[model samples]
Target: MPAILLLIVSGFYVGNTVLAEYVEKEAVKVPLEAYLKGHETGKPEYMQKAFHTDGKLMFIRDGNYTTIEFKDYIGRMNGQPAKDEANRKRYIESVDISGNAAVGKIVLDYPNARFVDYMSLLKIDGEWKIVNKTFNVEPKNSSD
Candidate 1:
């Protein structure tokens, strides 16, 4: 009887742990989905919802390392979809979470180039917000 009770308790603990992790993962996806919505709609409001007020994006441009404030980056969006929006594809590739910190991978496949973004996120005041982003772009040839 004691062994059966122990087994039941262990099962309960394992179930709770798995449920907690699933809940956390879903919570983390909230901000990531917002980020994707921003790209889909070309709206800064969505981006603002996804990132912290002081977030920034880092990448290499013209052979020089460059960083842009999230606000500035969103400001460049004209609230209009790209001309080739129909041909552009974007998605969250993966997300890994540990306590209050998490990281996400995103892919932006454009007609001319493919971009892979790594975003660092944190849970602040019970909300997950992207704190930083770094990405690399690969150009594609028309023939390929």
Candidate 2:
């Protein structure tokens, strides 16, 4: 009887752990989806919803390292989709979470270039927000 009780308790614990992890993963996707929506719609408000106020994006541009505050980046959005928006494809490739922190890999395939972005996120005040982003772009003609 004791052995059976132990087995039942163990099963419950494992089930709860798996359920919790699944919930966290789904929660992490919320911000990532918002980020993708921002790019698709050319709406800065969606970006703001995904990023923390102090977040920043870093990348190499013209052989120089460049960093832009999230606010500045959002400001650059003209609230109009690109002329070739129909051809643009954006998606979250993967997301990994540990405790209250998470990382997401995003891919943006454009007519001219492909961008791979790594975003770091933190769960603060019971909400997840992207805190930093770094990405690399490859020209469409580049050899894979």
Candidate 3:
């Protein structure tokens, strides 16, 4: 009886682990994918797909807190990839999810600047979408 109980417990543990991984992946995948495509292609449709309409980008500029609404931010994109796209690097560093909400950190390294982005996301109607984004951008030097 004890052996049988142990086997059942082990099976439950394995199943739980698998389910947790699935939840985490599903929670993080869509937003990151959209974010990557939008930045790489410089398209607003991809950005709109990833973010909520009211999402805002928050950052500090010249010692003042500044915000950019999603529409304006999307407008800043010129629908053209950066000239040095070959030298750019983008990565999703980490994501943490709880129930229907999540947070993610991403890094974008370009020839001219490096950006660290923090995204707040929620699962709305069975889909995960970014509701807010805040980032820090630093001008890059020729070396390092």
Q: Candidate 2: global Cα-lDDT?
A: 0.95
What CA RMSD would candidate 2 show? 1.7
Ordered from best to worst TM-score, the candidate numbers read 1, 2, 3
lDDT over C-alpha atoms for residue 27 of model 3? 66
Expressed as tens digits, the lDDT of each residue in 10-107 for candidate 2 is 99999999999999999999999999999988999999999999999999999999999999999999988889999899989999998899999999
For model 2, the superposed segments whose C-alpha errors exceed 4 Å read: 142-144
TM-score of each: 0.96, 0.93, 0.90
Q: Clashing residue pairs, candidate 3? A: none
Q: Each prediction's Cα lDDT score?
A: 0.95, 0.95, 0.89
Estimate the overall C-alpha local distance difference test score of candidate 3: 0.89
Q: 1-144 in candidate 1: lDDT tens per residue? A: 999999999999999999999999999999999999899889999999999999999999999999999989989988878889999999989999999999999999999999999999999999999999999999999975
TM-score leader = 1
The TM-score measured for candidate 1 stands at: 0.96
**Model 3, position 128: C-alpha lDDT score:** 90
Error of 3 at 5 (Å): 3.0
